[model samples]
Target: MYQYTPFDRQFVHARAAQFRDQLERNLAGTLGDDEFRALRLQNGWYIQRHAPMLRVAVPYGELNSAQLRAMADIARKHDRGYTHFTTRQNVQYNWIPLPQAADVMDKLAAVDMHGIQTSGNCIRNITSDALAGVAADEAIDPRPYCEIMRQWSTLHPEFAHLPRKFKIAVSGATEDRAATGWHDIGLVLRKNEAGEIGFQVRVGGGMGRTPIIGSVISEFVPWQQILVFIEAVVRVYNRYGRRDNAYKARIKILVKAEGQKFFDAVAVEFKNILERDLDGSAHLITQAEFDRVNACFVRPAGVVAQPEVAAAADLPLAYRRWLERNVHAHQVAGYRAVTLSVKRAGQAPGDVTDAQMDQAADLADVYSCGELRVTHDQNLLLPWVKAADLPALYEAAKAAGYATPNIGLLTDMIACPGGDFCALANARSIPVAAEITERFDDLDEVFDLGDIDLHISGCINSCGHHHSGHIGVLGVDKDGTEWYQLTLAGSDGSNHAPTAVTGKVIGPSFAASEVVDAIEAILDVYRAERTAGEKFIDAVKRLGLEPFKAAANARRTATARHSDTAEA
Candidate 1:
């Protein structure tokens, strides 16, 4: 984890103080609500459906025990007793009062955390693979580069207000765990034949009312010029991206409309930045600055390679299952990355209670070198777990209800806080997610069914990343009733599906009561149609959506007939 420097701490504190002044004036009838709207949004405060929501940035998903504890305290004292971890590697509080917003900011700053640039049509948090540094397949650690971009984008005068919200993700591993293809700007670090480090730049990928996979703009951009190249990309978007309509303001829209023309414009801008501007080369990352940032990402003091040990054949079946699902390989021998399952029965996916946060912090201190990482899949990861401590850690995690062995199973779905908390939600997402989770509570059945990415969103904003799910459920409003639209064959560009693409909608939306049954019917079709060992997504692609669509719609038809019979 990158340690905060003196300047970093000072800047965070100053920003908190500035927000405090603005908040006080707003409450005192001096600054109007309209005037304070942008100010509050810039600082990560939103007047949500019920109360003020604060989105605290967790840059690249890195966190220390101290920061985790601070957040736990805020969840306990200030608002609800839990926090929601988002797919973008950020945390949100849905019940914080507007007046106490400044106080919350102060507490966050005390631990080197804040909501800066977390909201409001600007460059959002710079996210990367949760297993960036430790993944066995990594080509280069991306944390240092992510931190560099974080510093550059925060409060950037040139990009404070773009046509719409923008996001960027980076992945250095051979596998795209960060879902780079779904970001406004996706960066994949690689080394050329000359062993020179550079990035594969993909721009214009996003999910919303319009979901598009990013196009590869540059095959290889030298690492030193990443900032300058990105500047050119955003500069072009800011100049031409749609501002008249909020729905079409994302760079994805511009990229989709212009296609090759958009890429050409960006290339021209990159050349202009490097050659036409007086300080063209000023933004180039110097060796010294890179070294300074890179040094902070080194292995923690006490963590080192240990003698490899074999797993005991006598281990409990449940424990073995947990190990297989939740533990991941690390680059360092004898070390593994362990995921704490926040998605389980009876809870919304990614919702962590205050007590659980504290427990997680304690686990970090004891088992993971006091460090943690938030994964893009809406789970917490102990990135430095010793292989020797697996048993003890598993036991502790089980006791805390975080040891469910369903990491990639259907039960481990991603869902946003829909109508329950979000004002923009067309329907409630929690109930749908809860129903699906309850229907798939049997681990044996889940494991047999194999890995599935089930994502649910309250609306088209795609906050829950429904567009990337193998089985996607999106909430839609039909007249005044809540309904769900199902899609199949979507992917997040992981090993499961090497290409990132939005799921294709099956057919008409189903009533809320029929969603769970519809999902069950669709899975039933998959089971009957799939070949031996075929994953759900592969089956969907091979068999097409027609079979599953027919099954789901049949369930809807049956339900409607049953209702008619009852009315008769």
Candidate 2:
């Protein structure tokens, strides 16, 4: 787990004080509403529909037991007891009072945490693979690099007010677990023929109204020049990227307008300019600095071998099923990665109460080194548990309602905060999510479905990662009513390709429960007709949408035949 340095702790404390003073002035009528609005955003406070929302940076999704416990306390004390984990890997408290926002920051600073750079037109928290350093395939840990980027980007004076918010993702492997292709700048640690590690850099890929996969602007960025190259790219974007139209502001638009060849040439020119200014403006990265960052993430000593986990071999058939489904690879020989599922049957997806958060921290304390990682899919991950204690860990997770074992199954869904809470949504996404999970009660049925990703977004911005889901559902508002638009074959996987629109609006704003039934109707047809070894997405691609859409819209049979399973 990461411990805050004295300087880190003090920095947050100072920021909180700064925000507190600003708030006092604003409320006392010394500061205008517009002035205070900008200042409050600088401190991660947002005025949403119902109340102020506070986004707390988790710092590459790594935190300690103490930090999480503090989060639970802060939520219960200053805001709602429920916190929402976003796809960006930060937690948002939706019902914070504006007057108490700075106080919330003060509470966070006490635990060496802050909400800085979590919003506004600034660099957001740098993200990496959630399962970094512990996947079955080996790569250098990406967290240390992500942390370095976080430090460099935070409050960066030069790029503080860019044309738009910029996002960067780093991956440590061939597989794009961090959505590297959909970020302003993406780095893949790579080894050259001489075994020298550097970075394979891509720029200009991002998502919004216009989604694009980044192109490789540099095949090989020397190890020492990583940060310098990134700076050059951002500099170019800051100067030339769109500021006229919000939709056109992302670097992707710049790349699209410039053409790939032109974009690559300009980037190369920028890289050359930086190299010439190495001693002046460019401080090339060094092995020592990398080592200094890497030191922060070193694993704890004496990772105990859990020989007693052999008891798992003698467990009931269902326990064995859970052990196989939820457990993942660990870099350490004796340890295993544990993903605590929040997707219990018939529950809202990606939600955790203050109590649940506390329990998660407690689980981390006893089994691992009081550490946790939040995956993009909204599950808590204990990354360094010993294998021999699997049975005990499993039981503990079950007792605490954290053991659903449906990490990537059909029930594992990504849904946005829709009409229930979000001001922007026209339809509710949570109940639809709950409906789908309950409908797929049989694990064997879902396992056979194989690697289905269902992502729902209440609107076009695709906050739920609908562009990445194998089955993408978007809520559209037509004349003050709700409607759903479905897309098939989309993915956020290693070689993900965006889904093609199925083009069948099954219902002109179907009722919440009816949508789930529509999806079930479609799945039934897939199961009945799919070729052996074909996944749902694969079967859809192999056969196309006419059949699936028809089955879902089979209204005559919908009532008696599981109507709630219709297109959730």
Candidate 3:
């Protein structure tokens, strides 16, 4: 994890103080709500359906034990006793009071954390693979580059007030775990034939009311010029991206509308930026600066390669299952990356209570070099777990309710704080997520189902990344009644599905009560039709959506008939 430098600390503290003044002015009626909206949004404060929400940025999903503890304290003292982890790898407090928002920001700054650029039409939190440094298949560690981008994007004067929110994701691994193809700017760290580090840049992918996969703008941009190239891209969008209509304001819409014209314009802009000697090389990332950032990402002091240990056949069944599902292979010998599942019955997916957060921090201190990574799938990752400590960690995690042993299983779904907290949400996502989790509680059945990305969103905003799920459920409203639309065969560009594509809707929307049954019906089709050893997503692709669609509609029809009978 990158340690905050003296300047970084000063900047965050100063920003927090500034926010306090702005908030006070708003409260005293000196600043109207309209005038203060942008100010508060830049600092990650939002007036949601029921209360003020604050989203704390976890840049590239990196966090230290102290930061986690600070967030836990805030949860305990300011907001509700829990916080929600978002798909973007940020943290949100749904019930924080507006008056105390400034105080929360101050506390966050004390721990080298804050909510800067977490909302508003700016570059949001930069995300990367949770297993970035330790992944066995990595081409180059992306953490350093992610940090570089983070520093460049944070409070950037030129790009702060874009037409719409922009997102960027970086992936260096052979597999696309970071969903780079779905970001507004997706960067894949790679080396050319000469073995020099650079990036494969994809631009304009996003999800909302419109879902579009990013187009490959440049196959390779030298690592040193990444910042400049990205600047050109954003600059082009800033000049031409629609601002009059919020719905069509995303870079994706601009890219889609312009196509080759957009790509050509960006190319010209990139050339001009260099030709004009803009900033006189100030924006260029020199090797010294790269080295400085890269040094922070090196293996923590106590972490080193260890001798391999043989697997024991006598391991407990539960522990073995947990290892199978939650433990990921590490690049270093005799180490593993373990996921602590926050998705379980009763609670919403990604919701971690204060006690749970504190416990996670303690687990990080004891087992992971006092560092934790928030996963894109709304889970916490211990990235430096020793293979030898698997049993002990499993026991501790189980006791802490973080050992659900369902990493990619159906229950380990991603869901946003829906109508329950988000005013923009058309329906509640929590109940839908909870129902599906309860329906799939049987581990045996879940494992047999195998590696399903079940993502739910309360609306079209895609905060929960529903468009990327193999089984996507989108909450909709029908004449004031809550309904859900199901989609099949969406891919987040993971190893399972290398191409990022939006899921196709199965059929007409289902009533909220029929959603779980609809999901069950879809999976039933998979189980019946899939070939041996095929994953749910692969099965969906092999057999077209017709079978799943028919099965889901059948369930919906049966539910309607039953309701009609009861009414009669």
Candidate 4:
């Protein structure tokens, strides 16, 4: 994890104080609600359905034990005794009051965290692969670049109020766990045949009412000029992006409207900007700066890998299941990245209690070099877990309610805090997620179902990244009744061409009560048609939607008949 510099500390503290002052002015009647609303939102405060929600940034999904403890404290003291992690790798406190919000910001600053740039129409938190440094198949660790982008975009004056919110993501791993293809700007660390490091820059990707896979704007931009290319891209979008309508404000929509002209425009701007660097303004990046950031992320000393032990053979079946599901391969030998599942039965996905948070921090300190990472799938990761310590850590995690042996199975789902918390939501997402999780409670059956990414969003906003899931479920309202629409073959940016696939709608919407049944029907088709090693996404892609559609509609018809007979 990157340690906060003295200047970084000062910057965060000053920003907190500034917000506190604005809060006071608003309470004093000097600032009206209309003006204060924007200011508060810029500071990551949202007026939710029940109360104000404050989102705190977990930069690049990295957290130290001290920071995690601070977050737990915030969850306990100011709001509810739990927090909700989002798809952007940030956490939200849902029950915060308006007056206590600034105090919350100040408390966060105490632990070197803040809410700035987590919301509002500006560049948001820069997400990277949770296994950035640990993953074995990565071209380079992307945390340094993510940190650089964070420093560059945080409270950038020119970009404070864009037409709409913008998001950027970077992934170094071959597997696109970071879902970079669904971001406004997606950077994949790539090395060319000449062995030169650079970025494969993709632009105009997003999901909402309109889902788009980012187009590769630049084949390769050298490491030194990466920032220059980003600046050019954002400048072009800011200058020509639609501001008249919020619906068409996203860069994806602008790119769609302009077609190839958009790419050409960006190319021309990039060339002109680089060509006119008389004072070398465009070349802000340097080898020295890269080295400085890289140094902050180097592995700690006195932590060499140990030889494998035979004691693993004596572990119980439950412990073994957890080990196989949650523990991931690492770049270093004899070490693994352990994902602490927050999606236990009866609990909403991604919701972590304060006590669980404290326990996670303790486990990180005891077994993971005191560092943790947050995954985009809304789970906590201890990125430096020693292989030999797995048994003991598993026990501690189980006692703390973090050891749920369903990492990538049907029960391990991603969901947004929907009508339960958000004013923008059309229906409740948590209850649906809970129902689906309960339906798939049998671990053996879930494991038999195989790797599935089930995602749920309350509305078309796609905050749950419903478009990126292998089984995407979007909550919709039809004539005041809550319904869910299903889509198949959605991806988390792991396709062959470095792009994402927006899952196609499967069939007609189903009632909220029938969501689980609908999913079961779809899964039934999958289980019947899939080959030995076919993943859910691969099976769906190969078999098409007709078979699944037939199964789902058949179930719907049966349910309708049962209802009519009961009425008679």
Candidate 5:
């Protein structure tokens, strides 16, 4: 994690005090609600349908045990007993009062956390692969670059406010864990034929009302030129990105309006401006700076696994499953990336209690090199756990409600904190995620479902990444009643698939627990008909949505089946 420099420290502290003054004035009636709304939003406070939601930035989703403990303290002291993890790797407290908002900022600053750029149209959190340094497939640690952008983008004068919110993601591995394809600017670090690490810049990719996979504008942006190139991209968006209608105001719209050929020409012209005028060339991260950032994430030592833990890892069945799913190799030898599964069958997808937070912190102290990462998939990651200690670590995790043993299976779901907490949500996503978990309690059955990525969003912000799931469920309202819309063969990363709306389930709004069974039922049909060794999405892609859709819609009551709620 990047420690705050004196400048950084003063920046957040001063911002906190400024917000405090703004909040005081608003309370004193010197500032109106509209005035305070912008101020609070820029400071990352949102007036939700119920309470003021506080979004705390967990940059690149990297947090030390101490920071994790601090968040647990905040959750326990100020708000609810738990916190909601978001898609961009942020944590939110849904019930933060406006008056206490500044106070909360003070508390966060004490622990080196803040909400400074968490909201607003400014370049939001710069996310990277949660498995960055530890992933076996990575060519470089993307966090250093993420931090570089974080420092450059936070409260950037050029991008303080945009036509719409802009997001950027970076990936360091062959696997696109960071969802590079769906960001305003996606940077992938790659080694050129000359073995020099550079970036493959993807632009115009985003998910919203208009979803498109970003096209690569530059195949080889030399390391020294990354910042300049990035500025070029942002500047072009700023100059030409739509501002006419808020709904169609994202960069994706601009990209669509301007074809890739035009975007390329414009980006080229913009890059020349960055090279000639802006001297970001000097600020490019040097080797020494990279080493400094890398030094703090030192590999840990020591591991003694329980006999049964070793046995489990050695089991031909269990070991192979664990290796394929649980173990991701690290850049450091003798260490492995361990994804701690909190997304269990029958559990809320990303909900963690404060006690569980402490337990995770403890695990990080023991086996994980004193670090914890919140993955975009709504799970916690102990990035560098030793292979030998994985069994014992797994056991500790099992006891602490951290071990679920389902990573890519049916239960490993990503859902947004929906209507329950968010004013933008059309329905409740937590209960929907929870219901599905409850119905699919059998680990064996979940595995049997085999590599299905099911995502649900209460509404279309796509926070749950429902837009990118192998199977996505979107909730929509028909009249006053809430109904769910289904999308199939959609994927977030890896040969990315655009979200597909399969069919509308006709029936009374199913209980949250029942949705899982409904999904299981849909998968059962796929398994029965799928060809050998086929993953869920491949099968769905091989065979269209007809059969699965038939079975899924069958559970709909006769009245619900024919109702006008069906959107497709």
Candidate 6:
């Protein structure tokens, strides 16, 4: 984790104080609601459906045990007894009051955290792989680069307010767990023919009403010039991006409208910035600075590998199941990364109780390296757990309600805080997610179903990244009733896939009550149609939507016939 320096501390505290003053004035009638809207939004305070929601940034999804404990404290003291982890690796308190917003900011600043740049139409949090440094297939640790961008992007004067909210993601591994294809700017680190490491820059990729995979503008950019290139991309969007309509203001719209011309313009702008040194800050990012940032993330030590214990045949079936689902391979031989599943049965997909957060911090201290990484899938990662201690860790996790043994299964769905919290949402996402989890609670059945990425979003803002799911469900409002539109064969980031594809709509939308049935029908079709050893997404791609649609309609017809027969 990046430690906050004195200057960083001062900057955050000062910002918190400034916001406190702004809030006080607004309460005192010096500032109106309209006047304070932008200020509140930039600070991550949203006037949501029922109350104010505060989104606290977890930079690159990295936080130490102390910070986790602080978050728990905030959750316990202020809002409800739980907090919601977002798809972008941030945490939100949905029940916060307007008067206590500044107080929450002060608490976050106390732990070297803040809500700055978390919302509004500016560059949001720079996210990367949850297992960035620990992943076995990593080309390089992407955290250093992510941190550099985090420092550069936060409250950037040149891009304080873009036409729309922008996101950037970086991937260090062959497996793109960071969902690089769906970001405004996606950087994949790779070595050139000469073995010099650089970035493959993809721009204008985003998910919303108009979802599109980004275009590769630059094949390879040297490490030192990354900031300059990013600036150039944002500058082009700022200059030409649509501002007349909020829906058309995103960089993806500009990219789609202009085609290759946008890429060409970015190249020209990048060259101009590089040649003229438009910002003197670009020169400050030399190898020494990179090294300095990299040095902060030291590899964990004192790991003792107990091969016998790890390989024990006498291990409990529960522990083995958890090992298979929750544990992941690590870059270091003796260590493993463990994902704590927050998508347990009968709960909101990403909701975690304050007590659970405290317990997680304690477990991190005991088994992990006293740090945790928040996954894009709305889970937490203990990135440096010894393989030998996994059994004990699993036991502890189970007791703390962290061990669900459903990491990548159908039950482990990605969802957004929808109509329950957001004013923009058309339907409630929590109930939908809970119903799905309850319907597919059997671990054996989920395992048998195999590697299905199910995602649900309340609306078309795509906050849940539904377009990336193998089975995507988007809630819609039609004639005052909640309905769900289904999409199939979508994927996020993957080196295995031919290309990352946005899910296509299957057919008509289903009523809220029929969603689970529709999902089950789709799964039944998959089980019957899939070839041996085929993953769910691959099967969907191979077989297409026709089979699934037929099965879904069949389920509906069967249910209607059964109802008629019972009535008779």
lDDT of 2 by residue, 1-568 (tens): 4556787788889999999999999989999989998888887888766777788998778878888998999778877687877777888888887788777888889878899988778778887777787776647677777877787788999888889888888878656777777778888888889987778887877755776777788888877777777777887788788899988988888888887654666677566867698466675666787787787777777774444434434678767767777887677777898988977764567778899889999999998778888778877889888887778899999999998767777788888888777777777788778778778888888877766778888877777877777777777787877767666666674533332222223334444545677777778888899887877877877887788777766743556366447644
Better of 1 and 3 by lDDT: 1
Q: What TM-scores do the predictions have?
A: 0.99, 0.92, 0.99, 0.98, 0.90, 0.97
TM-score winner, 3 or 4:
3
Task: Give the local distance difference test score of model 1.
Answer: 0.93
**How many steric clashes between backbone atoms does each model show?**
0, 17, 0, 0, 6, 0
Steric clash pairs (candidate 5)? 346-437, 435-512, 435-513, 436-516, 469-490, 487-500
**499 Cα displacement, candidate 6 (Å):** 3.2
TM-score of model 5 relative to the true fold? 0.90
Residues 184-262, candidate 3, lDDT per residue (tens digit)?
9999999999999899999999988899999999999999999999999999999999999999999999999999999
Candidate 3 ranges with C-alpha deviation above 4 Å: none
| Stretches of candidate 6 exceeding 4 Å from the true structure | 278-284, 301-310, 495-498, 562-568
Report lDDT per candidate: 0.93, 0.77, 0.92, 0.88, 0.77, 0.88
Judging by lDDT, tell me the better candidate of 5 and 6: 6
The global Cα lDDT (0 to 1) of model 5 is: 0.77
Q: What shift in Å separates residue 332 of candidate 2 from its native position after superposition? A: 1.2
